[model samples]
Target chain A: MKISFPYMGTSHIVVSYLFEKLGFEVIYPPTPSKRTLSLGVQYAPEFACLPFKIVLGTYLEVVEKGAEILITSGGCGPCRAGYYGELHKRILHDLGYPVEMIVIEPPLVEPLDFLRKLHKIVKPKGIFNLLHYGRIALEKLKALDVVESTLHELRPLALDKQQINQAYIEGLELIRQADSVKEVIEAKKAALEMLESVPADHTFKPLRIGLIGEIYVVLEPAANHDIERLLGERGAYVHRSIFLANWTRDNVLAHGEKDIRAMAIPYLNQMVGGHGQNSVGEVVRYAEEGFDGVIQLAPFTCIPEIVAKSIMPAVSRDKNIPVMTLFLDEQTGQAGIETRIEAFLDLLWQKRKKQEAS
Target chain B: MQAYLGVDVGSVSTNLVVIDDDGNVLVDLYLRTQGQPIQAVQEGMKQVEEAIKGKKIEICGVGTTGSARTLSGVIVGADTVKNEITAHAVAASHLVPDVQTVLEIGGQDSKIIILRDGIVVDFAMNTVCAAGTGSFLDHQAARLNIPIEDFGGLALQSEASVRIAGRCSVFAESDMIHKQQMGHPTPDIIAGLCDALVRNYLNNVGKGKEILAPVVFQGGVAANVGIRAAFEKALGLKIIVPDYFKVMGAIGAALLAKATVKEKGETNFRGFVVSDLEYQASSFECQGCPNLCEIVNISVDDKVLARWGGRCGKWDTLSKTG
Candidate 1:
């Protein structure tokens, strides 16, 4: 069976591996680009969030390439994302594409149903082999996260940013090519070593900026217009609140502690759906950690993020941290975003200067 | 005889200013951009030279700011390339030393900058919306067949203010037409528009921002007395519009260039003769990737000067080295 999935940052690397292990021809969609976005935008319901349109575009692309099965995560929140699976399926059906769509809801939401769905897909191979392959995929994910985090930390300090970019690409390639847990571990070590060895001005002090927002735009560079790279290039240390591995461990494995969510209780006591509460919680955490500034990124017209954005100014005032929110969508111009970011950085720099003088 | 030149190439107009070492304005010129920024900039340079005919001013530094800052920087060899917000804030502070808030309405965008102790503390710009900008007012003026220069004077004659929707330009236009069809006076309609635009600016771009005094309002739209009065009536604070209101961005760029040159002890001024050079801007879609980024290349005398607009830095890097 040929299977396909949309790109969600580096998640595709590990996802394609798992599908190959499950004995399926995995044909993942290409990185979200202008062509894919237009295709998706052409047929998507007006006002759908950016991620939906991009993913829909990817599905259409893969369908054109003869992919028969499509696998996507199902959302379980009040946000519109929860209905995207059904909407996309309907749209594709209306477009006359005879493709089977598999929606994977969180296991905690429906444990028996989840296993039943899994049983239908996976061969009756022993559980041990499945576990082994899952372990390797998880390790690869962890390695990719480490490499990305390292790049974020070291990029601002590097004299030759090109070297850091090259190392990051090489690290991703190494992680993608590794077939076993041992090889993944070795690849991770090598990648880290290569990243750390890049020439850097260690004495430089970079302004630390925390990024918090909706999951899709936060993780996907294509969606957010490579904001992480832009911030890093401009001598700011970027600390993102989300990672694929951390999200999986928290959502799927349910292993992470609840302390982070607790941070939002003072401002947003209940679940407002999606990552709205998490964004507020992360901003509080970033403020407490003495970060220079915080930026919230989300797709335009996003409901949960609008909720978060409404309360951000109060959080910013109370915490005494500067916060800026950027809404990403089709109409987002790179120049406008860049100008705002530059002005935000200027504000941070001037604030720091005033503090030092005092 | 040393002076710094600043160019602000915006969507609607191009402004040029020359300031002496002590930051005294020597010359200021504002011209319509009219969709051709390159020609507008070159024409601005020629005019600046003509205006300072006998003044033996040496171009010690150059700066560029606005939407076309990067392109203007390449043409003039600017010592500083800064964004419009910072330039506006800097210029406001330079003129009104104790300015706490700045409300700037330009052609395509409007922004509010909150400053404390001469440092930018908070700011916000309208996102993908041009509802309450200079272009909005200009379009209405043109549609009403009233000369744009007479828009403010006519608006000032209103006895009763009509309420016009200003949520979006489209809605505002339709609402204005509806009001006109209802036999409302032109001055009242114009006055209503000014009020609606001010309300929209304060509610949207100026949302959640503390608009403290001494407030400075400067931009192309500041020339409109109607909008200025609307702002004053809304906030109940007297607005300060600098003498060089329309060219504040260029003045700010000049001020920044002065500071940059003071620090670096040198300048990147390519000289006034660059105005004589033939400049061309051309763009093509890149075929190497599915992104199909439209790459823009600016050249002078058939030699490529710079390339940009590509998501990947391949063409950008190639332009620099080649």
Candidate 2:
């Protein structure tokens, strides 16, 4: 079966490997672009958020490329993301596209729903067979995640830009070659070892930057223009706020811990009602941690980020941290970003020098 | 006594608030943005000037927030220019020592803030949608020919609630019309609309985050008892709407300005005379690249004050003569 998947942060990396392992031909949508955004904006309701537009863009592009089965992830909450899959399906149907959309909701929430989704996708012979396949898939997924995380760390350290690019290409190739769970594990180990050999100058002082923002822009390389790589090439140590492990801990396990903790200080936790609290917390933490700078990345027209943007100044003041907010849209230009980044780095270096002189 | 001035110029509103050295509000004014932020800021400053007309107020610091903060800051010679999130979180923390989640649905957008121990940890904003925003409700009210002032009161009077689809404004409109055609009473439909809006907000903007108790609902929408009741029913928890709901952003800006002044020991306010000046704004689409950014320039007496919005700093560099 030919399967198509919309990009879901870095979740695609794991799911793609799993689909390939299950003997399904996987066709991933091309990286996000202006054309993708335009197409999405045209078809989607005017009021849908930018993320929805980007996702719709991916689906439309992949479906047009003749993929039969569409795979998407699902969520549940007060956030708009949970309902995107349903709305997307309706939109595609309205647009006269005949394709089966398989939404993979959080399986832990409802076991029956999870089983139903699995049945629709795989049609395993029995429960034992399904479990067996699931184990192997899970193993592969874990391995893929490990390699991706390691690469994320190394991408900012390589001496030459080409070295980082080559390392990623090699790692992706290894992932593609794995035939089983054990093979995937071995492949990940080999990829990490290969990355370790890439030479680093160790002479230049790395500018330490903390990246804080919404999930998609933080993890999706295409969405962020491979920001970590760009900054790493300039000898900056990029500290990303979102990690798969942290996400699982926060959203899956101790999901409400932050809110619960905020309860003691009602003024701070006002629950103005969304990700605004989390954004503020991350900025404050980054500031307290003494990062040279903080970059707040969010899709254009994102409300929580707007709130967070409003709050960052005081965080900057209280902790004496400098923050730069980048609002991404279809019109975001490479040169414009590069200039701002360079200027920000200059400011950071100047501050460091002034601190030393004083 | 030392004082600080903070201006928050949002797309829908412009606000100016003055705070004393101890972070106490002395003067506050909130006005419609009316598509001209310069004029709004001038008017807001005039109100602030008049309120503290006789007090020996020394402007020791000035800060700006919101979408138009940059322009307003440049015009007012602000000591600090910041974003809305930090300012709001800071003020919210100061006001309610234990605010966990901040639910702010304003004229144009909605925001959710997750706080941990007086610091913001996570946040989400809905700047693109009208469904979960006050504008959507305003539009619906105009269509229903219901006075926006009486909307919440009428909604509270409903004995039976009618269900309206709140997925999108278009969908909600059709659903509301369908309900009305089915002989649903105005009060029931209005209350149902409020519930539908609340449902849409939870479904769209608040997805995937844990919403704990001690939620504070601020912004202009907080005044609507119907929506507040709907939120309470939906979340099964009481929400605290602060006394200064409509001017929270402005108040936050004022508090931030106060903090900055205490830390920096100076101010750069242009004062109330700015209200009498003629400010003009012009925009030109940059043709340097396909981005075609509409660079906006604001000026006083043909002398440029600030230039922003172009993706590339081409226009910014050119307008540096200001």
Candidate 3:
């Protein structure tokens, strides 16, 4: 069966590597675009949040491309995210497409159920085989994060942006086409070296902006209008708090970072909803990390983020790290986003000068 | 005399302001956009030049803001392009020194800016819904058979306040009609609308942030006296509406332009001569990928100056290169 999944930044690349190991053909849909958004808008409820629409759009695009099996993660919270699997199933069925959906939740929710379903999909011969497969998947995930972080580090500093982008594309290509873990390791090393050797201008120091918010909007470039790249091009060193590997390790394995949870306790005593606690915690973490500023991005009308956004001003006031929240929807214009980013950079520049003077 | 030029070409209005090195407004022009920003900007610029016919004012810098900022920046060779939030905050703090908060409601959108020591510490913008914007007032005024300019004065004459749902424009309009049919005074209905819009802005765009004073209220809608009074009643603080409130975005832009030129010592401004030239804009769907992003191109005298509106940076990169 040709299996497909929604494109959320580099998540598809990581998952593709896993399915390849399972000896299954994977149909990777093109990156979510305006067409995908339009499709989602047409079918999704008028008041549905932006992420729901984009996910729906991706499903339509990939399904039309002849993929019958779809795998997506499920959340358990006050947010509509938990119901997306059933919702998408009905949407696909009504649209007259025959598709099988595998919804993966955190093992904490149902450990045996998660493992049993995962075993069926991977078809592991035995325990050792499962262990080996898991190791490879985790390794690939680590390498992906390394390559992505390197790209962000080099993007604004490189004299020739094309060189940075070229190295990144080639690095991803190598990993995508690699047949063994050794080749993947070599590819990651080459990518990191290429990024480091891109010849950066030392005279200019880019502003450091921390990006934190909902997993879908923060991780997916298209949903938020490629904000990271847009900020990077304008001389911002972007630090994203959400990574697929880190998120999976924290959620499924219950090995999440303890500091964030501890930091969030003052403002957010308990888990309010989907990523609500995490959003507040990440902002505090970013502030303590000496970030120049922070940007909180979430879909418009997102209840959980709305809750987090209300409490964010208190954190910003106490931390002294300027926080700007952008609520995205289908109607959001790029010019508005650009203007805000530029102005924010302007504010950060002035603040830095003021601090230096003191 | 060395001066800076700022242009705010929004969807509803295109405002232009000329400020001296000391941030004093030398000239300001406000004109309706009428769905054609290009013509509106050219006409506004022509008027500004006419007003300064005898002055040999040298433009040291140029800046732009509003929804059409990028397009206008390209047309005017702007050195700085900023968003409305920062622009409004800067202009407010400049006019009302020690200003702690700003309430700016434009034709198509509304925003709130909270400042600390004249630097913007927090700000929020609302472009998603129209319940809290000026267009809703314009629409309601037209439906009430009263000119928009007189809509505010009518509200001031109200004997008592009436409650109208301001959560959505569609609901507000129907509620207003219902109120009118029940024989409510015209002034009372209009006053309720003013109050409704104020409540909407406070609840939506003004949520979470502390609305501190000395607060400055600006933008096209600041002209409405009733809304100004509504803000005062709701916040229980004096709202300062500057003399140049309607053109504050342009003023902030000019101030920013001055700052930008001070750092660089040179301006990219094309000058008033741009008014006499023609600019053409067009769009085509890029077939480079399945995304099919519609790339728009702007040409000045048959020389393509800019291309944008693509999700991927391919078109933007190609345009800058080629």
Q: For residues B36-96, could you state the per-residue lDDT of candidate 1 as single tens digits?
A: 9988999999999998889889889999999999999999999999999999999999989
- Report fnat, model 2: 0.02
lDDT of 2 by residue, A1-358 (tens): 7788877555666667667656678887776766777989899888667788888998899888887788876643555667888898888888888778887655666567767878766662445554665566556556656766666566556675566557766876776677667887788888888777788655666678888777777777656656776677666778877765456545533344364326323225554433556667776777667788888887776676776777665666667777777677654535445534654665566566766777
Q: Sort every candidate by DockQ, greatest first.
A: 1, 3, 2
- Per-model lDDT: 0.89, 0.73, 0.85
Q: Candidate 2 on B112-172: residue-level lDDT in tens?
A: 7667666665555653356767877788889889877789889999999999998878889
Stretches of candidate 3 above 4 Å error?
A124-130, A253-258, B317-322
Candidate with the larger lDDT of 1 and 2: 1
Best by TM-score: 1
Put down candidate 3 lDDT per residue, A1-358, tens digits, no spaces.
Answer: 7788878887777788777667667888788877888999999988888888999999998899888889888864668888988898898999999899888877776788789777767673455665676677777778888898878887889887767877887888776666567877987898788888888986788889999888899998788878888887778889998877888787656646567768899998877767888889988888888989999998888888888988988998899888888888996457777867877887888788878888
RMSD of candidates 1 onward, in order? 1.7, 12.5, 2.1
TM-scores computed on chain B for all candidates: 0.98, 0.94, 0.97
B1-322 per-residue lDDT for model 3 (tens digits): 9988999998789999999988999999999999998889889889988988889888789999998888899989999988877888889888899999988888888888888887877777775677868888888888888999998999999989789999999999999999999999999999998999999899888877888889899999999999999999999999899999999999999998999889998999988888998899989988887667778888877778888887656776644545
Model 2 residue A223 CA deviation (Å) reads 5.7
